[model samples]
Target: MSQSHTSQFALLTQRRFAPFFWTQFLGAGNDNLFKFAFTVLVTYQVQVAWLPPAVAGLAIGALFILPFLLFSATSGQLADKYDKARLIRFVKSLEIAIMAVAGIGFVTQQVAVLLLCVFLMGLHSTLFGPVKYAYLPQHLSERELTGGNGMVEMGTFVAILLGNVAGGLLIAMPGVGAQYVAWACFGLAVLGRVTAQRVPVSPATDPALQINWNPLSETLRNLRLARESVAVFRSILGISWMWFFGAVFLSQFPSFAKEVLHGNEQVASLLLVVFSVGIGIGSLLCETLSRRHVEIGLVPVGALGMSVFAIDLYFASRGLPQPAVSYTLGSFVAQPGHVRVLLDLLLLSLSAGLYSVPMYALIQMRAQASHRARIIAANNILNALFMIASAVLAGALLQAGFSVPQVFLVTGLLNALVGFYIFMLVPEYLLRFVALLVSRCIYRFKVHGDEHIPSHGAAVIAANHVSFVDAILLMAASPRPIVFIMDHRIFKIPVLGWLFKLARAIPIAPQKEDPATYERAFQEAQRVLREGDLLGIFPEGAITRDGTLQEFKGGLMKILQAQPAPVVPVALQNLWGSYFSRVEQGTAMVRPFRRGVFSRVGVVAGPAMPAETVSLDGLRERVGRLLAA
Candidate 1:
């Protein structure tokens, strides 16, 4: 997390967060432990008459996911309609019982019994998914949300890594065999439930809301509730697609190491370890890179890396010799071309962590608080659907003669297309990417009183317009998206204009210059504020001809009359002398040739004023005070 924000590690010490965190971590660890143990049993130890090991693996995947499909809707409603802490405790208890059943299956070596345990484990997870995520927003502050999610994500993948290692080692032990794996599962389950008992109470969001026991109708309703917001719904799609992309990479690892890298179980475990570690590191980095804000800018960065690394992994594996038998871990690493594959896996997984944490935080922050659990339930359903699709698609492709590396190639290319579509559909992700890039590279920007900005809801921002880059500067500093109101002429510029359009900036023309454009801009501004979006306007209405405060105009008065949102007064300092500003006293549009590349700039945000108290003179005074500081 940022220096300004509370440490994510500190969260582990808090009563409100620690118990729930451990409960979820232990539960996730238990899931992977049992799952991988089953895989080991099928692959090496046990013989099944009905199906081949490969087919059994596919069936297990389907069986595990099926419960999510069947039970997620009911679980979502339960989270919303009952006490979340109690629901979590109940789910944890169910996990203990399910693991007991799994232990018996392992002791007796009954494949059917083990498979049923997988389905029951899935059912247990489906019930907890909604409650686990929704509980965060209720307990943590908005500024803590990103850091909190980072810790949770980091803990989860680390647990997964440990579980995979433990499961493989336990199942392969000489004397104990599957018995140790079974006992470990039972113990972890019990520990998770015990930890969950200490979680602070989380009251029901909608206690009186009718329970929908029917999975079919409740699932439909859940999806509909998720669809209520375009941003929230699209974020869900981004998350679901990430799972699809990740499942492809992960599910292929065992075969990829054996067939492509010609390595044994150790090498296979190495790949999983690298991937999980990459995700854990990347997840923890999200808080720092985002300055402890739920910055979606990292999403595109992650998507771009996912494709690049996947493509590179394909090329790295090209022309590899096929050894008759798998190599030892040392022999595998000593191979000439293997390290590239490892590096690609690390980078790919890191990007994945960067990609997912923010989307999860966004859903938690943006979704209606009342239905947040159900929204997460909707996300779980979609994730399961995508994972199932990945399995089917990969199976079809492999059956159709696509090699593992080729599948990586195809998925990487598909990521580019899907990522582009998502970014276009929700340009906020793209805009934030640009904002972050510009802030780091183009300017040494600093912000003061940024906490005055609200994390949610409608507000009006009145900033002194100094440069053409003013909106970009403000947008870079702002945690949330701001719909900037720009002069119509500036809006018609080439490359920057396209970026502004993507950001959904409103272009205003002076009434005397263009009446229709002026009317439309104000109308659009009103609509934007009414929808609870941030609307930014330059009180001066245009860039200053001189490096001085221009008179605050009456257009703000018109906007306030139409839609009264809380007015946040802001000022941009030292940008008047920047390259983009009109400080050079020349006819040229830009003077980058005359100015230094990285100039120091600051944005100061004044305390928000009530709608009724905002006026032209008052705003001018407030912005003037901030500018002077």
Candidate 2:
């Protein structure tokens, strides 16, 4: 709720965020602690005919996810209908009760009861999932969404790592291991409840909504609600795909360490440590890379890196030297090829963190506010299904005599294909990717007065266009999407034209030259404004043939007369001589590398002028001042 913090770490000091952060951190840690300790207990100490050591982990995982399939739809509705803080406190209280029962099971070594506790804990997480995601949007501003999600994601992985370590150590005690595990789980549950109490009240988004008790119908309805926004629905699928990709690596780590790397259990733990740390680092970096906005450009970048590193991991481990004996953590690190293996895993997981955090932030930012929680619930259900499918696919691969490395290879290739498919379906991701590349690599692009761009509602951006890539750079500068009105001639260029088409940029010609195109462009611009979307226009009407300001045209004035909206004046500076600009004999792209790589360029926006008072000369003067500045 606090907007004063600039860095994500500053969030840890605030009451609004700190309490929720710790509550969820402790809950995640406890979940892993209880499950891992129980897993070790069954695999090493207790024996049951129904649950064999080889399948104990699988059985626990299945039971845990089963609740999500059955209850996520109901939990989503409850989250929407009740205050999230109240729901959080209630969930924490339920955790305490579940742990109390788990304590008894741990002490008595009742495998069935402990297994039942796993299902209960899964239920606990299911109830909390929708609330956890929906609560962030309620409290944090759009600028804070990415940072908040990053902190929560980083904290979660760290907690899971610590929980697994503590659980293994406590449950391996020479005597009374089970009792120690029981006490630890109970204490964590209590701590979580205490933290939950301090969380600031978060009001329900849809308090008056009636409850839908039936899971099957409600699940379908929730998904339909999510699909109302194509971008949001696809983002949910992207997040689910990330879970599927991650589930493969996580589930294979132990076996990969033992069979591929010839390492002991401690080595497997070391791999977990490396992967978790990588994810935490990457999660925290999102806020910095995105410049405090929800930037989805990083999604494609993340996907590319995930595939690259996963494929490299396969090659890195394909022909590893078989150890004469099992390797301990120390000796494993001492090996020649082991570093590459660990590095591959680390980078792969880091890419995963980058891939997922933006999708989560995007979903929060774009989903309909009233149905946000249900949408998140739909996401949970899909994530559960994907993880389950990952397990089945991985199991089948292994059964078909594929090595772990070969499985990684297949998954890596599959990731590339899936990413391509998703990007084609949602060109926004690819569009952002191009914007990110052009801004960060082709030029050292910077923005000033970016806050002047309205975060919501329809607004028009009036700027002096300098280069063919001006729209792309502007796309990088603004956090939200902008529909641009461009000269139709620019649409004839090969790659740039395709990109503009993908961005849905409306192209126009002079009324005398093409009356229909000119009229249609204005109609589309008005429709965009009516839909509360940002419309961008080059008020100069065309790129300046010389590296100087051109007189502002009346097209922007025409649009404003038709659809009243505030106009933000923007100037693109130091871009006239760049490769994309018309600097070489008054023709753009005639000569390459005119300014070399990383050419200094800037986009400056001034405060919005009310639509009623805006004029062509006044707007031109405003842009001129910004260009000089």
Model 2 Cα shift for residue 516 (angstroms):
0.9
> Tens digit of lDDT per residue, candidate 2, span 253-311?
99998998999999999989999998998899899888788999999999999999999
Top lDDT hit:
2
Best by TM-score: 2
CA lDDT scores, all candidates in order:
0.89, 0.93
**Which tens-of-lDDT digit does each residue in 1-629 have in candidate 1?**
12365578899999999999999999999999999889889888898888578677778778888989998888888999999999999999999999999999998888889999999998998999999899999999777888899899989988988987898889998768789999999999999999999999999998988988998888888889888887889999999999999999889998998888888889998999899999988899898788777889999999999999999999999987777678899988888788888999999999999999999999999889888999999899999999989988998999999999999999999999999999999998998888888777877777888888888889998999888878887887777889988987776788789989988898888788899999999999999999999999999987887878989999888999989989999989988777778866633346674558777888899889989999899899999999999
Runs with alpha carbons beyond 4 Å of true place in candidate 1: 1-3, 321-325, 586-589, 593-595
- For each candidate, give its TM-score against the true structure: 0.96, 0.98
How badly does each model clash, as a count of residue pairs? 0, 0
